[model samples]
Target: MSIELPQRPFFLAPLDRENSGVDFLGLRQANLDMMGEMIPSINNVTSYIRPFSLLSWIYWKFHDLCTEAGIEEATSDDLRLFRERIEVLFTWGASLHETAERIPGISATPPPDQDGVKPLTFDAWGRVQSSTSLIAALWYGPASKTVTGLGFLSPVPGRGGFFRVSRAGAALAQALDNKLREDGERYNRLLGTLDPVEANESDAIALWSLWSPETVEHEEMASFSSALTSEEAIGSNDTLLSRRSTTFALARHHLQEVGAEQSIPKIRRGMCFSVRPDGSNYDVPTTLEECRRKWLTLQMRQLQRLALETLLSWCEDQILRYDVVDTSAMAERFKKSWALTEYGLGEARNLAELIFKLDTKSNSVEDFIRSVNTNDLPDPFSIMAEITEKFRQRDPGFAVPCFFGLLQCASFAGAENAPPNMVQLGSAPRLSLRVLRHRLVGLGDVTVAEAFEYILEAMVISQHFSTAVNRFDGRNQRLRLAIEETGLTALVSSAWVPTVTEDRLAMLLTLSAQSDLVSKNFDGEFFSNGGIKNESI
Candidate 1:
């Protein structure tokens, strides 16, 4: 049976401009609906989860696994990708036009002979006219265009729609101004109260207070309006520009340079694409792409951390609601039957213990949300920060179920995969199967059979190293022995082609072996275990 969660209105944290009561959650729902209509891959409700934390953890974990396996080649490839990304950032900064020229298909200029004709395009991005409409299209996504055409928010007189929207935008700007002023006051107060040692620790907060509002110049607003409305606007780049938060930063810096003195216009209503206005200053390297890469990367990290924080908060709240206060007390609580509970206390305890190190002393959920600083955590992709130390441990226990649920949501796995055997089996085997299923399902867009082969390939590569063993357990015996005695490496290597049914069955059997539910000989194959039913496979 599928895990059917109670239906509730989907919630999306508001963007800076959307803070002016712009119906952020409504817009996100509409966007999701529109995207589902446009792209088959994103049609499922589960697709909305966007589990960046889990995905990043898996990738970094895989990297660690590769290093442990002594697959130097795979590790070296990671280094290559890292170096290339840095180089790409440098290139993006130096000259966007030049970089576009070097990348054959990437073009800053329109196609030959089509430059003069006005182009209107529609696709997964919805309908857009040109750069002129970019601000509107991106702010509300498809909602702006559709809502406008329906005359709900038309620019036509007496509609009051644009007026309301414009007012909303104005409200957003006012809110930011108010916040900056407040932050400035707070910074001064802290500076005055704190000693030198304490002051040094407050640098990040102080920088935030000082730098955020300063990034905006009161004069640059008119130039920004001009850039949005200019006759030279093209729609193709508008989609790219709309999705990019750094574009706003670039525009602000430009207006500042040109000395445009108009107040920054209230962000138009429906424009919810702006990143949280932390007021980071950008010296703006020579190229737009560099600025974009830096900003996007930073926002991604921030977003992932925010999502994780949200999850942790929810988990903590669940634990508190259960009134299980002490860590040691959880074990006793677990002994009681959890038949009526929506989730076992065992599960809640596991999640709490895992993230216990990261928990703060906030009295309420709101307080935690307001005060928790994501920057205090390690870098976004760091396993210790995102997945925490619990996952790195051999058995994460009670945390397994919730994480598996998250993994299912992230992968857009159909309901058919649910009510897994783990539900009936005891917790230990359940955890192993859940982890195995996670690895199996998380493999790149390939069929289960192909995924099986991919794992086999990793195992084959791993077998070459005599020291390699399953990281799941401290002992390095089974996999190593299977590799050496049964010529498992040679067998798997010979079957390097696309996956066949038998090969998939073999891999499933191997997973069963890993779970200790099946007996295995020196060869990496499973033998009959009377305890496991055929349907369990």
Candidate 2:
């Protein structure tokens, strides 16, 4: 996302416009023709301009121009002009050569030559011998005046082979080496400066070492062989086979360690099973079905444990977030309601009461549902719908109990027992009686019964089972017991039982509320007073 403008395009003007006599199109065609003949010569002279192919071509062209100019036997002044032109061409070529040498993978050494004067000469095969030959020819023949005063050429005997070494030549070689060393040092520094997050020094070093001439030559040989061999094997099947074998071997070891003898027979049966005796490509099984089954069972068992832990954590977090008004009083009330003969119910009730008291100001069905951070709460509507569908597939009539069981789970205070019931409750009966009764009483802010009925219908349609009647039943029972303990309900009737109604749904709701009230009271007391401690311990 770095916002930066792109570079502008570069356009080259027509050469004909710069040189009136030059036909840009014709010149290009002529150069293409010359390129066909000069490739071999260019290759031969490449050594002198080591890394620069374009520079080698330019040097050859300058020599050709000198020859065409007929300045070989010209006056000193004319020769000076010719030498200056050739010198400019040579300088340009050298600059290009140096640039090519800096690029990774390009050869820095120039081509060599035997006959120095005719540096542009090619062998019978049209291959230029070396860059040295090209440079020597350019200097001695075309730009000879530049080096004549410098004593670059020495006279030889009758054969006309002159011993030649110009100060410029020596200076250029040193300069090339120095430039190369500087470039190498800069490259090393760049490699060292790379961000550790993107690339480490080791990686940079490996890349640099890989570009060495020796490494390149070795790689070239390997690549050439690979190219020649049409069927080059890049990866080995043996490695895959070894990995699969190791996995099965590990599984077998684990089975033996666990003393699972039945698994051995299963494994043996799986191994012995045959699909077909014919040599068909699909006859063999790629995977061990028996091993996979055993692994899945183990994985499911681990997942069940994780699910329980997650539920426990959710409950703990919910309780921790709420504020209790009267922990001791709530605990006492909880103890008496459940008729505790053991500590299990007492302790559980005490914990529940503490949470309830603390969260009393903010306590609501929505808060409770939100407190349960299980993955099940994310899309309750869809999840409930899916469960209902699953139940319908098994037995449509059972969907009601399935739904009620799910509601019960949402209302209840435990975790380990919720999932299986929630899953199976989809197939149960429509126990709306208890749910309806609780909704009427719990949501008594509206005096009209129609409002409660509307709420119930909406709850069913939206799958918002979190506010179903059983939750109110549980909460009311706790509230009544708390009131009893505190003597706050002396003026009101305490032993009232709601009348049963012909509306089956209403009756069911009332019945559910009554049942939950009695159970919660009894269980709360039992746990509060350590009645169930022995059983649990």
Best-matching candidate per lDDT = 1
Give one clash count per candidate, in the order shown. 9, 51
For candidate 2, the C-alpha RMSD (Å) to the true structure equals: 36.3
Off by over 4 Å in 1: 1-109, 114-133, 139-154, 157-218, 221-384, 388-537
The candidate scoring highest on TM-score is 1
TM per candidate = 0.19, 0.15
> Once superposed on the true structure, which residue ranges of model 2 sit more than 4 Å away at CA?
1-287, 321-537
Q: Write the per-residue lDDT of candidate 1 for residues 1-537, one digit (tens) a residue.
A: 344543885533322221121111111222232222212111121110111111122233334445675665443344323322222222222223221112111222222223332121122113232321211232221321223211112142553212222322232233333433555654343321211111121333343433232132222222222212222321123332232223333433333333322222211100111222342222433434333332322222222222222223222332434533332343333223222233212332332232222233122222222222333322222322233333334222323222323322222111232223211122222122233335544563553223323332332223223222222133112221123332322211111111101111222232223323334455332333433211110
Put down candidate 2 lDDT per residue, 207-235, tens digits, no spaces: 33323211222222232222111121111
